[model samples]
Target: MTTEQSWWRRNRWPVLALAVLLPGTVILTTSSEWFDYQNGLYSHAVTVPDGQSAVYGGAEFRVDDTVLVRGGTEGGDELELDPDMDLIVAVLEVTPGKDLVDSCNLTISATSPAHPEKRTWNANVDLPRKFPPTGDSQTTCSDSQGEPYRLVVAATVPSGAAETSSWVQIEKIGLTPNYLELELSPSAVSSASTSSDISSSSTSAVRRDDLRQKSNATASRLTRTGSTIRSITNPIG
Candidate 1:
């Protein structure tokens, strides 16, 4: 080959490499990302119901409780939340305390989007009159969709109890949400490979030859994300 031809041959790959790399670097750096992580919600002032057979050791009320329900399920057929991933986290919280004085059972759970069922977790008051009521509880759950949750803390007390009393005041509490994340598959969102999962040199050059199209596809994904959020807020049949 002539000297000019030899020079071009030696520099050709490097020149093409720069061409491929510069734009890719720009695209990747500007590319938006969505990652999954954990989040929590806290409860408002919580109160048990009144007039059951198991009041308190003496008083007919419960102490204010601050509950932190993190993302999931401790057991059983978990509530199918994520129709896509079907992911769920069991949640439970309680400050240490002694057993109740009267033997009464309770159920707590969120009653609405703004209200969670508190009756899902409960215990008997106490027996033979113990001092300072105490009980611990937990549950498997998904976060609310950002709203108020009226926690129904219903106590089921045995009727005609000789000594122990039932019935306490009920209270509505706080609610929270978990970070719901989503990623589309090839079929769900067909486009150029955004990134090679592998960094090996072997497949590095296999990026889509159509740069303009890849860019358009990337931006369209954000729209898809918005659509997903809307669906989650109001799902279709």
Candidate 2:
């Protein structure tokens, strides 16, 4: 082996577990989620560093409106998401160009994707002491209810002394959220496929509502989205 290859082969074992596990987990993450024709996929990427004050950039909601977010907009702002939607992924960037003094303060705010008007989920990144060294802090959303139709993730700095909280000064947020894939019941997607051989007399016996239902289900396409994400952390918890 060449000198470079020989050196790497000898010393690589020290961090080998991390190197192997990292790639396995990443590969597992993609196929773990599915995307279909009826349902749409939505995702975003952001950068918030550890220990540095972050400036929030406004995010556009599916509602066609935009909300502004910055360093001090706390108290957990409310966001409206669309009903009949299924997935939301918030990707954060944790790699800093320079060494960080502390970990990043990552937060997320989410609501039902299927049914709107439901309460939101506000969660934050929990640092495991060896943050920058071990792994990144990300909000990978894995589930959704197709009723609300929107997902909101908010990123913010903790309301404490910069040095006090283990999470502060987020240089970048690496957003990597889970899928909100749909699982349509047979009745929801293929109700008409159930129809069997019938006669003109059967049509006369069928209720008018059944015909109406068939008309509604046939040749149908829907588009639903959620409210604007105000800021990163304030949108969630």
Candidate 3:
């Protein structure tokens, strides 16, 4: 046989093994993702109406309020934002069940025509703007202290973003992928005129104490219209 034929003959077994193993490795690596996609965990959401409560990850959750802050505070250091940006805050009432609340997470996500894919932001704890004192409220699920607690979550959005629709999603822990989606009612609040509108004592409950501790370098002053809020990243595109 020629040199080419001899080489092919010598390597035939190894080539056959590689061909089989390559496809097998790919399938094995992608099986979990494929299963999640097929089960609708990646694309499905059960929309929950506003002011309504639902059980998720062994915890009861309800979006108590939503606010869209526009202006800045009167005195002290103020955070300036891009003209196209605005602040959005959501208050969630959480009552943990047998499961530890720490295992679950809450997030605010929005969908707009400009970006069909969902844009998600965490409950930011390091933003400069201070909200009102959230008497007895917990900023995180883990700090619930086995009692019903309020979760104050805030995120900055593009100006007039998600006017059509936005939601508060509770991340899945040990539960099914069918997660809860609570609709947000974004009402305007100005810290300049009636700063207490977004205060923790009001219906729109939020706290700036813990966040102040985390981001002392930023603005401690709460503005009337808005603040230079945190930018949103990590789109679930």
Task: Please provide, for model 2 over 1-237, each residue's C-alpha lDDT reduced to its tens digit, 9 standing for 90 to 100.
Answer: 655567767788867987998998987776555533212322422333221222222121121111111111120111111111211112222222222222223233322233333233222333212112112222332112212112222222222111111111111233223211111112211222222111111122111322222222332211112222232332311
The C-alpha TM-scores of every prediction are: 0.17, 0.17, 0.57
Of 1 and 2, the candidate ranking higher by TM-score: 1
Higher-lDDT candidate of 1 and 2: 2
Write down the worst ten-residue block by lDDT for model 3.
228-237
Q: What overall lDDT, based on C-alpha atoms, would model 2 receive against the true structure?
A: 0.24
| The best candidate in terms of TM-score | 3
Query: Where is the poorest 10-residue window by lDDT in model 2?
Result: 160-169
TM-score of candidate 3 to 2 decimals: 0.57
**Lowest summed-lDDT stretch of 10 residues in model 1?**
68-77
lDDT of 1 at 54: 17
Cα lDDT, all candidates: 0.23, 0.24, 0.55
Looking at model 2, residue 174 earns an lDDT score of: 30
Tens-digit lDDT track of model 3 for 1-237:
655567768899999999999999999999988987756553457676655667665667776556555433221113343345555666666777666657456677886668878887765543435445555556566633677777777666665455556788766654445666777753323331145233322222233444323222232232212322221221211
